[model samples]
Target: MDANRTLALFERLVEIESPSWHEAEMARACEAELQDLGFTVTFDGSAEQTGSDVGNLIAHRSGNADGAVAFSAHMDTVKPCAGICVMRVEDERGEVLCSGGDTILSADDKAGVTAIFEGIRSMLEAGGPLPDVWVILTTCEEQSLLGSGALKAADVPQGVDCFVLDADGAPGSVVCNAPCHHTMDVAICGKSAHAGVEPEAGVSAIQVAARAIADMQLGRLDGATTANVGVIEGGVATNIVADACSFQAECRSLFPERADEAKRQMTDAVTRACERAGAHADISWTLDYPEVACAEEDAIVRRAKRAIEACGLSFQAVRTGGGADANCLRGLGVNAITLGTGMANFHATTEYIKVQDLLDDARLVEALIAEYAGS
Candidate 1:
């Protein structure tokens, strides 16, 4: 691939702001690029479900080979993505990309996006045997893979092995294990009273929440299980004892049983805290996405390993505490794996990608497609 052309694509995409539920402009740009590459691009009907301005982009191109390979990436970024300005820094190791501004660099998946396109271009221009290539650009992936979860299985072509380019490692890293995400919301009800006049006559819901959180087992409980409370709200003012409190908690694990056990432990902690405070507890749980467990012997995994090795890079399997598009794809029986795109400190202002890493990632993507094509 031409490094300058690929870098231009990345910079152009980074200039466009595409936060979760707002990927309309990004989708348009992707559609145009895909069309220029002789791809038939269409949009899925998942906007209403994901609340995105646009749906997922499905681009396809036929080939002479027997098998098909699909490359996937999300089209959204986290907040503070508007007005991004990318700056190139010269490091001894190589050139490094940074925003050098208040907002994040948005390389979290824009790196993935441009890498796939560049790979396709390079592979297609090689004039070798080719396999059918399908590109699925999803929306709202930052929101627990909401866009992927809303995808219809029929939308993606059947029997097309796939992988997601949305992990945080160098080119050859593969996320073989990913956790199942389960979230719980709790609401505690208590009696209200004036703090100064009758403080003892009422129970503070915030106190109950504090008690429960303190008692809960959280923050990497074991090798594979983890839980945390991320959102909490209660009370109207300081003068009155808080009558109600609500908080959001979540647990994730590579093992389903372990995730379930953690959820139960969290719920029991809240129950005990409410019991001690003489308060009523209302709780609910939602399974955001399922786990991803791809064995080395799996065809897709084997192909990826070989492709990475063929590109002269190290290959290693990893487990992530977070979720990816692969997590949702597994539930659809697609069994897509997650591949690294060298995005460091994603979702933060310090996010960056090494120039060498970007070139290597593109080469690896091209190798992956060629490996599948039997070329």
Candidate 2:
């Protein structure tokens, strides 16, 4: 592959601002690029559901060999990514790509996108036997895998194993386990009263919420489970007793039952606090995404290991506390595993990836295609 050409593609993609729920420009660019590569690209009808300007881009190309493989990457980036300026710096560690320090480089998935695109270009130039390939570029992935969750199974071709190129680590690292996530919104209601005159008449919802939070065992519940109360909002003024309070919390665990148990315990804590404070509590819990665990011996994982080794990288299986598009794809019955894109400090202003890592990722992609093609 042409290193300069690949770097140019990465720079162009990072230059485009594609925050969650607003990825039309990036989607259009990807569509045009795939079309230029002789792939049949189409958009799914998930825009309305995902509330994105455009649906997921699903592109397909026939191959000269048997076996079908699918690759996935999200088009959305976290906030504060606007006005991004990519800079290439050479140091003792070799070439590294970074933003201007005022904004994120958006290399989280753009690096993945660059690798996939350049890998395909290399394959085409070599004119070697290849497997049938499908590329799915999704939007709103920064928002709890919204894009991939909204994707319809019918839109994806059958009998195709999926590979998600959106993990944070070295290029050879594979995310084989991710936790199930559940979000909870709790509202505590109580009567208001004058703080100075008749403070005794009011049931302080703030106190109730504080009590509930104190009673709950939050943060690092166990080896695989964790709970956190991230947001809290309530009360009108300090003069009057607090009437209502609301908080948003989340629980995550590698096992679904553990996550559910954590939710139940938190709910019970809220109930006990409300009962003691004579306040009414309203708690709602929703499962954001299910946990995904792919065995190292699985066919897709084996292929990934082989491909990584072929690129002279050590294959390391990892478990993540975060979620990605792979979670939704696995939920949808696609055999999927997430591969690292050599991103470091992602979602931060200091995010960067080594240029050599980018080239190695592209080579890994090519190796994967060849492995699937039975070459």
Candidate 3:
């Protein structure tokens, strides 16, 4: 791979401000890059549903081989990512790319995108017959996985496995399992009245929500299960009894049943709180994404292990508590796995990727494609 070209591409992507649900200009930039790489690029039209400015970008390149393999990474980043300036600094792993103290570096998955693109160029330069290569750059991946969830099964290629390059850690680390994520949104309805004039006739929705949250077992429930109340909003004034309160909470577990039980327990807690306060509680539960698991002997795992080793890195199959595009892809009935790209402090202003990690990731991508092509 051309390390300089990969670095330039990564810097260019970082320069673009592509917050979730606002990936129009980023999509166009990637589309033009794909065209330069001789790929047939198309839109999946998922923007109409996900409310993103652009749909997922699907790029394909016909190859001289029989089989096919896919690669994916999201084009969206979380907040505080605008007007990023990529800076090179020294880390233990050598030179690193990061933001310049004001905004996030947006390397959570842009490094993944760069690796995939550089891998294709390297494969072509190696002058071997290539397998059919497909790329899926999704939008709205940060906010509840709206982009990938909107993807239809037909949008992904059939009869092959896709490698999702959007995890944290070393380049060779593969997520063997990812948690099943669930969310709970609640609306607490209570009677409102004057605080001092008719206090007895009023119910405090904030107090109801507070009591519910207090009764719930949040934070880490176990080694695999975790829960949290993320958003809470209500109450009109200090002098008036609040009539309504809305809250958002979430939980995840590597085991599906455990995640379900966590959500259930939270719902029960909300019910108990509402009952005690004489308040009506409305709760909605969503299984955001299903778990991803692969056996050590699974063909996909074995192939990934070989590819990782081929790139002179130790292969590690691990579990993760976070949800990713791999989960949504699995829910779409496609086989997928998440691989790390050495992004550290993601979603924060300190986010960065080692320059060597970028090169290693590109090498890993090339090796994986080579393994699938049997060349």
Candidate 4:
């Protein structure tokens, strides 16, 4: 892979401000690049559902080999990235890319995108036998994987093993397991009265919510489970008893049963608190995305291990608490795993990626393609 070319592409991508739900410009740029590389590109009709300017970009190219493999990366970035300015600096370690101290570097998935593009370009330039390749650039990944969730099975090619290049770690880290996430919205309704005059006549919803939260076991339920109430809203004034209180919380667990049990416990806590306080509780739960676990013996894992080793790096399978496009793809019966792209401090202003790491990621992608081609 060409290091300079890869860095140039990375710079271009990160400089473009494509926050979640607004990836039209980035998609257009990627589409043009893919088309220039001789891949047929098409945009899906998921924008209306995802509320993005453009849909997912699906690019394909036929190769001389028999089998096919798919690669994916998201085109969206987190907030504070509207006017990104990438700066390349050299430290004792090596060359690193950073932002202008005002926003995130957006290397989380852009580095992945650059790697895939450079890898495919190198393969094509080599003019040798290569397996059929499908590249999917998704949108709204930062917002709970809205783009990938909207993808239909028909949009993906059949019998193609998929891989997502969006993990945050060294190039050789492979994510084999991720937790299932569920979000809960709770509303507590209580009678309102003047706090100083008729305090006994009012049932404080805030009190009910606080009691329920205190009774529940939050933050690290066990090795595989965790819960937290991140957002709360309600109350009118200090002199008046609160009439309604609402809170948004989430729970995650590697095991589905554990997550379900956590939800049940939380619901029970809310019910008990509301009953004791003479209030009514309204709760709703949503499954954000399912868990994904790939065995070491799986073909995708095996190929990825080989490819990582081929790039002169030790391969390590890891479990993550975050959700990615891989979770949705796995739920759709596609064998997929997430691989790191050497992004550090992602979703923050301190985000950065090493130049050598970018090159190594490209090499890993090329090696994976070679493995698929049986070269």
Candidate 5:
């Protein structure tokens, strides 16, 4: 595969305005590109549910028709800025870099998309091909994996082993473990009264929430678990006792038992705090995504290891609290693993991926395809 060509493709994708739930134009461009490569493409019914102008772009290329290997990536970026202007830069050492200072470069998943595209392109352009390659580019992944969440179980073709190229960190790092998260929103109700006149008559919801927050254990919990409250809102005026308060928080853990324990402890803490403050509090919790922990002996893991080995990179299994589309696939009972693209400073203005690493990722995907096909 041409490294420059792969980088050009990634740059072009980032330049398009494809934020969560608004990926019509980018999806169109990808459709044209895939069709040019002679892949059978379909616009899955995610646009209607997501209220976007387009749905997921699912492309297929069947060659060595035994079992299929699926490559997946999200086509959306996080909020703040879109319609990116990707600039290619070279430092004093002449290493290639790509970015735009004001907005995100969107290498998070765009790199993933480009790698899959390049892998397929390389396979097709060269003589012979691997097993059937199924590609899925999802939407609304930044908005909590909504597109993949709505995907029908039967729609994903059988014999399709899963590979989601949407993790960060180092290129050689393979994410064999990720966490499940629970988001909790709490609203506290209290009675308001004048501070100087009748301080005893009013109950302070802010005070109650404060007490609750202070009492709860937050930040990193153990090695694989963590809990934290990120958003809080309440209080109308300074003089009156704050009657209504609201808070939003989350708990995550790599182990299901640990995650479950964290959830139970958090809920119990919220209830106890509200009861102690003499104010009523409503707590709601939602599981953001399921956890994924593929054992070393699993076939998918073995395949990924062989692929990584074939790419000349050492593979290390690490557990992470960060969730990804892999969580969604794992939830559907599909064994999947998250692969890294060597992106740095993600979700920030300094987001960037080295051009060399980007090309290496593309090559890695190609290697994986060749390995799987040979197997």
Candidate 6:
């Protein structure tokens, strides 16, 4: 496979704007590219459900008669409107680096998408033996996995296996464990009264919220868990005792019980604070996505480790508190793991991926396919 060709494709994909629920043009581009690669592609109804102009793209490439293996990634980014202008560079050690400017280079998942595309291209060019390959490019992954959530598990091809190439850190690092997240909104309602004249008659919802927040345990809660109240808004005027306040919070943990425990604590704190202040508290919580924890010795994980090592990189399985498309693929009952594309500083303007690392990831993908075909 030509490294330059793959790098070019990665740059092109990152430059495209495909943020959250706005993935129309990017989805179309993926569809066109998949079709050009001689794959039969289908567009699901996730767009309408997700409020996007385009839906998820599912493509199938039939080769050897072996069971199908799918490679997946999301087609979106959390952004500052940065257009991909990838620059290829090498340091003294001859490591590949791909970057643009002050904006994000979008190696996050774009590199993953490009790698999968190039892998397919290489197989087609080589001709002869190859396993059945399926491609799933999802939308609205950044908006809490809405696209994957809307997708029907039964719609995925039969006898399907999957690899979601959308993670960070070293190339060999395979994320076998990730956390489930609970997104919540807490509202506190209290009776309003004149602050200067009848302060005692009024209950302060803001005070209730303050007490709850003070009592809540946020940030790091052991190595595998965390909780935080990110946004708070309440009250109308300072002169009057505020009658309403609300806060948005979330808890994430690798273990289901840990997340549930955190939510329970949050609920207790909010209820106690409200009751003490003679106010009503309303709590609404939603499990944004499920966790995925694959054993280190699992066959798929072992195969991926071997593939990475074959490509001249170290292989290791890891656990992460972050969620990804991998979690959603696992939800589909695919034995999947998240692979890094060397994306750095994700969800920030400084995000970048070494051009050489991008090439390495592409080679890693090829190695994975080759291993599967041989097996």
**In terms of TM-score, how similar is model 5 to the real structure?**
0.84
Every candidate's CA RMSD: 3.3, 2.9, 3.1, 2.8, 3.3, 2.9
Candidate 3 local accuracy as lDDT?
0.91
Q: Which model is ahead, 2 or 3, in terms of TM-score?
A: 2
Error of 1 at 328 (Å): 2.2
Q: What is the lDDT of residue 57 in candidate 5?
A: 79
Candidate 2, residue 64: how far the Cα is off, in Å: 4.4
Instruction: Give the TM-score (vs. native) of candidate 3.
Output: 0.86
Assess each prediction's global lDDT (C-alpha) against the native: 0.90, 0.90, 0.91, 0.90, 0.81, 0.82
lDDT of 5 by residue, 1-375 (tens): 788799789878888888887888878888888888777999878778877667877788776645568888988888545657777777763454546688877887888889888977887777665677777788888877888776665656554577888888666678888988889999999989997789899999999898888878789989999999999999988899989999999998889898788778877777787888789988898877788877888788788888888778777776777788778776666566788887777788778887877887887788778866764
Model 4, position 334: C-alpha lDDT score: 66
Candidate 3 lDDT, 86-184, residue by residue in tens: 999986757999899799998888999999999998899899978989999999989878899889889888656889999998999999999988889
Model 2 per-residue lDDT at 96 = 96
Distance (Å) between predicted and true CA of 331, model 2?
A: 2.7
Looking at model 5, report the run of 10 residues with the lowest lDDT sum. 91-100
Cα deviation of 155, candidate 2, in Å: 3.4
Between prediction 1 and prediction 6, the one with superior lDDT is 1
lDDT by residue (tens digit), candidate 1, 1-375: 779988898999999999999999999999999998889999999999988999999899998887789999999999799899999998774689989769999888999999999999998899888888899999999887889999888888665678799999888999999999999999999889999999999999999999999999999989988998999999999999999999999999999999999999999999999999899999999988889887888888889999999999998898888888888877776668899989999989988999878888889889988998883
Question: What clash pairs does model 5 have?
Answer: none
lDDT of 4 by residue, 111-206 (tens): 999999999999889887899899989999998899999887788765577779999879999999899989999999999999999999999999
lDDT of 2 at 91: 80
lDDT (C-alpha) at residue 89 in model 4: 92
| Regions of model 6 farther than 4 Å from truth | 14-22, 49-51, 78-83, 93-97, 100-102, 140-154, 157-159, 345-352, 373-375
Report the lDDT of model 5 for residue 18: 84
